[model samples]
Target chain A: MKYYGGCDAGSTYTKCAIVDETGKLVASVTSRSRINPVLSAQAALDEAVATLDDLKGAKDLAYLIGTGYGRNKVPFADENISEISCHAMGVHVVDPSVKSILDIGGQDVKGIAIDADGTVLNFAMNDKCSAGTGRFFEAMAHAFEMPLDEFSKLSLKAKNVIPITAQCTVFAESEVISLVGEGKPMDEIAAGIQLSVAKRCFVMAKKAAATDSIALTGGCAKNHGLKQAIERVLKIKVVDLPVDPQLMGALGAAEYARQKGLASAKA
Target chain B: MKDLKHLYYLENLLQDANNNLVREAQAGGRLAVGSVCSLIPEVLLSLPGCFPVRLRAPNTGSIDLGTYYMTSMSCECCRALLERAVEGGYKFLDCIIAPDACAQMNRCVENIDLLKLCDKEKFFISYSDVPMKSDETALRHYVKQMRIRVLEQLSGVYGVDVSDAALRAAVLGHNEACRLITAIGEYRKEDNPRITGYEFAVLCTATYCCPKDLLVDKLRETLDELGSRQPDSGKNFRARVVVAGSEIDNPDLIRLIEGSGALVVADRFCFGSLPGRQEIVLNDGEDVLLQICRQYLAWGKCARFMDTAKIEERQSYIDELAKSYHADGIIFEQQKFCDYWGYERALGSRVMRDDYGYPVLSVDLPYAVGTNAQLRTRVQAFVESIEIKNIQGKVTR
Candidate 1:
């Protein structure tokens, strides 16, 4: 009956995942990230705990692990782990067949190579650029005057893939505006944006030598259009996860808490 | 786990380019010769009346003005040095001896000279054409350049002795400090070394920034303290790594790596003790300058050495260090926008990991890594990966 917790305070949102001693996911919740990661973590965990009948509060969990960019600032976390390692473990737990992962988060992009046992073999990350990340998609979505989710889906209806040449987010946004002004189809422009991000991810994946099956994690994983584009670009299968892809980091942290808490108790 | 007695004092010495020791040397009528690259033989500058102080901009928070002048695309370290120069931080220098080894760094020195940052009446800057390939012809060029550019400037401008006897005397003092630093660095090879890498980096960096003669006694004492000092009982580090990279003047990068659970057992970067602190063997049969230039060319591992033999030698040098140090992996890092290291790190990391069969983590970091979470996470993940390889019995070593 013992429970464990994992909170991922990411750039754009805070996600919390809860699991039992056996590593069974009981509840998972997502909340908008606050200015302070500590508050964001507490709010997300409280929302997760509210979904379960047995838990009174986040304190009821036997152990809690904080992860992502704001990991060190999470005051209630018993431990902190990097989001890279967390994503590897979470994807491996959900699907052992995945050997590589492309995690496009709010502000950064990560290409991680993992082994069969959920150990990270190698990783490559974008260097201080927002071109091939969730932020890029959000900017494109804002220019299109639509919700982010609707913007991602619009790419599916594209009849032609227009090439977006700029490798910078600001320049690319300006290019998108010009394309819109030039009276290009909205779906094709959205398709170009997704494909541009997918191409950048491929270069990073090549750095890690990511071959075979890969999975998409982070908030951008919800974008089916981007997933298909990545599959096309990497020429590798993008495996499906039964759980929400955005909860992978939190789930991975929760799994670590369960394993470590049990090991501590036995010791 | 006990700190070295001189650790805090040495750390404070590196805070400013014009530190207490430099001031003391100046007060004692010694000239501070600014040096940029390891290509210029350090002993030649350490002649009787002058000392070599490797240019570094410690705690450089902003390089905006530097970027404005040098453009934002050059090496951050060079930009930071230029920034420090523009702020009149290097006004204490008598003359700067620069080499054409790196174009970006040369630009930094050129900017300093053009702007006349150092207002000392006799202040001058010498830019020499150093050879990249280490051959007999190149050695002759190196000797000639060091004589006309480095040696003649100090002797002519400040009347500092550059005689064979003076050079030999300088070598003796340099050798003494090198022996002490090398002896202290040997402890890192122990199963549980008495010294940490950050402590070693601080000690090593001080030898380069401060006058070598003044640090000899303290280094000797520190070496003695390490001989009997005991490490903490349990293993605090998860993995042992060799950090090979571009100029790492700041020790916080080492501190960050150690904080991420990897112990840096070997430092093969610029300003490190490996080749820089190795003693220069002398003989009565040869000219002191010729011998010194020959030894430095052999020790050249910088990526700027583009010859095929030197290129292969650089990778083998890292392999040799990893084996001798018993390191579990290698971290090949570079300063941002450094063209030489940008190519070298990409090729070297792969060659070490795939061809040499060692786990390698390649990264490009800023000039100063002050509580940088991104770099810390990269290092932590690398340590975990190495640990997992050990557990899985997949580690080749």
Candidate 2:
């Protein structure tokens, strides 16, 4: 059985996903991408390969594709595609009807519109600032003395929502502190922060002219509170995916490698 | 980035334009005329014994003194150029002919005179009005006023007689320089151009800062040097971009865009080499001044003109260029808070993307397109979108 591998070495984390010729995701692994992306990619793939009982070694893989901010830096990969295209491909593989994607990574946010075949039709990115990104939530979590994972859970229990006006992360952190001092409920502030992020993403997505059939991807997609905020702002139901949202880029990269390999073998 | 032989000489001329070339002419009893606008009649200024040097501030950093005189809310370009002048950068200029190119330039000239930035007695400063309307009557008025306000000053104050015969020769020299610069620009028409956008920008910027009489010869040698070189098809550029906006004298910006997998093939800007420099055609028995006035008026439209005809002319010019060059998209770049382009970017991006069916990236950049990571990431994603659109092969709605 032929197999292909894809690695997405993002700024915050690196994920590797392996798929067989039939497009079955056999193994997947994630690890923190510290200083060097190459090491993180290698470790993620190594862990996935080792844990999967039926998998063969590296030499058995037909093709290796890389994606993300450090996509080009992955020395062992056969090809490097942008994470935007990767996310579109990955989303289409799981839910072929998804015409758009919202990917909020640790450092940037992307609003992508895709065609029926998972090819990107149009896209917009917000890398200029950290206003409406995963890093902003991480910074807020650090300030509130809670784990980033608890932000969505805690915010969902709020009865009153207070808006966070500052867009800059540094200024917003201070604003959050002051809001806390004013004796406002922490859950309400968290709910307000998620809404503010959703509003920023809404404007960015509007720039691409994307309207409907959107699926959420990236590490931030796991936050249920942010998902509700996005659905409220866009006024549409976000598409559900079969696999982990963070694994989408890697899955897309592997899908591309598989398609390219099959086309070459036919030729 | 093929380093042509002329690049070295052009770099030296741009670095010390006032001292190396202009001063060499100044020492030989030739007057150096300072010009600020592309609409300025360069052929009239470059008389038999005068050197008409177009003004620009290269790689400018701080503008505290420039801001003190022009204030902080003014255009960045005006401040940068004024900063250099206040620091005694234009010591070689005998007279400054500041045309009312834009709103800020008129005030720049006013500040120069009010502050006596150059020598009060020795330097002769003059302002000539360029008509905003594109009509035969307006063109005629421009010709008449140029002769009275510009030619008369050269003869009366600077003692330089700009005769018809001398003006004809100057037009020929100007045309020769424009011809050679256009030749270098044509090399970029190839699928993978041997000349990168940054190199082309350098060659074009040299036309502004150096003596045209000398630039023509170096351009000829460079064009011949490029003859034996093969077309660069090995580079895997994601898209071909046409940079459209106001005054793009910054070669670093072009370098940054090209560095991000997009090759800049054509541009529509104020001081760029492509649309800015047009080959002047002077017919015998037709007044040379009238022909010069007509060509300068009918050339590329700057952002100041707001009429429907001028708007259509500018859009069609860039669209035709995009079609001919096989450009994949347009990058509309402007300096922050530029008054004219603040409107043009919105209108131009809409027209390019909606009417012409092209991908347009509108970015407001600082004058310095230095290593800003955010800007780089934005450009990278824009180019990637173009690449993916190509792969999709669908005309986006």
Candidate 3:
């Protein structure tokens, strides 16, 4: 059976997904992002291939699509599609009922409205700001001196919600420190940070006219606190994807490769 | 697409406010009347022995000083212009005739006036209270302001001719340039356009920045050259779109949009051909100044025109342009921090998509869009969405 590959060279990490002609995701891998997207993409694909018994490397793939911030820089990509389109496709393929998506990536947050067929009907994104993104959460976690997963878990134990007023990441971190100095509960502050991000994302969702249930994608999608906060602020349900949320971009790219590769093969 | 011969020459002219043609016009004993807003009737400033050079600070790198003075919260276009002034960029102009519109721009001009930046011995700045409402009362106020603040000032200071005959002659020259620019812009309506949006932007912007009479010959030749120009096979663009928004003195925004696979079929923004380059139809019976003011008032679609009728008309105008040009979608953009366009873009984005049944991409852009990756990504995604809709046979108006 022929195989397809997709690489998502995001700002924080490079993810690769390999799929068979039937669109089943056979193997996938994630690695820390390198400064150069090409190197990161190659590394991720090679790591993914190492997980399989038969596949050797990218050469074994029938087609490959590159996506995310470093999409154009992926040298071996047969095609490069924006992460917005890729996310929409990835989510639609996993769950067609998800009409909207909140993709909080490394540096930016996006609100995407999708059609029944996974086409991106409309989208809205934060411009040159990092208030509601993976980076923001990572920074907060770093300030709390804990791992990201633990930081997100700490948010669930909060007894009160402290509001984060500063829109800038640096300022918000300073505010978090001041709150710590004030002897406030760490879990409450953590919940506040998640809620701030959620509030910002709610504005984007409103702007994009997101409706029905929305899926959470990107690295931060794993943060249960953020998911709950998004649902609370948006007053809508956040649906779960069958696959890992962070792999959506790569999966969508791989799906496109499958479709395109099959069409060319038929021709 | 093949480059228009005059494209390079005109593009280079836009790099500096004091370009070769402006110098040539000044050296020939003509006054350079600097202008900032469209409400300041361009024809009045282009009277005999004077020409209007709409102030633009191209290749702007840092607006630190501008930010210090105007504060960072002011409109970036206003800040950039102020920055250029602080850098002695507008030293070539004789005077500035601006509308008392948009508070940020007003503060910018006020700072320039207060600083005495322009060192010309007879340098001056005139502020005219142009109307926001385009009614009969507004027309009279517009005409009266143009007479005293713009016309009388030019005639008084530089002894420039502001007579009815002079205004008539200026209108003729302005109309000639407008006709050429409009005719060139019309080619974008073709299924496969002969001219790219970037080239058309350069041509249209040149008419605004340089002396119209000086650029007329080149525009005429360029327009004639477009007659037999063939478009590329299968089309390079994934979709055709109309760009509507705030002032786009810099064409890099259009280039960025086009580079993302959307062919800009119509321009409905400031410094664009729609309202800026349309011919000023004249009458033999009425006063030339009164007639000019009336036409400009009617054409006012800027968000500063707070009237409910004008706001509704603005949306209708975009719909008409999109339908006429056969555009697949519309891109509503605004210069960041521009309060007028900020609200306009937000409202227009919703109305155009929900009411008009068009796929609209709304964005707020910086003044100089130099390969902004975020904007490019947005445009690329917008193009893909439009393509997908087309493939799905969705009737996107």
Off by over 4 Å in 2: A35-61, B8-36, B48-57, B60-97, B104-127, B144-157, B232-238, B372-397
TM-score of 3: 0.95
Evaluate residue B217 in candidate 3 and report its C-alpha lDDT on the 0 to 100 scale: 99
Specify the poorest-scoring 10-residue window by lDDT in model 2 chain B. B368-377
Per-residue C-alpha lDDT of model 3 across residues B102-179, encoded as one tens digit per residue: 999999999999998998999999999988899999999999999999988988888888889999999999999999
Query: Interface RMSD of candidate 3?
Result: 0.8
Local distance difference test values of all predictions, in order: 0.90, 0.80, 0.90
Interface RMSD of 2: 2.8
User: Per-residue lDDT for B226-297 in model 1, tens only?
Assistant: 888989999889999999989999998899999888999999999897778999999999998999999999
- For all candidates listed, what's the TM-score of chain B alone? 0.99, 0.95, 0.99
What is the Å distance of residue A213 in model 1 from its true position?
3.8
Question: Could you give candidate 2's fraction of true interface contacts?
Answer: 0.23
Clashes of 2: 0
Candidate 1: give the clashing pairs. none
Error of 3 at A109 (Å): 0.5
> In candidate 3, which residue pairs clash?
none
* Least well predicted 10-residue stretch by lDDT in candidate 3 chain B: B388-397
Candidate 2 per-residue C-alpha lDDT over B1-397 given as tens digits, one digit per residue, 9 for 90 to 100: 4578777767767665484767667778888888887767777888888878887777577888888987877777777778888887876688889777677777777777777777836688888887877788879888987988899988998677778888888888888888988988888898778887777888888787767786677788888987777655578577898888887776778888887788999977766865767788878888788888888888747777677899888888878888888899888877666888878888999898999889888887766556665566557767867886777675453
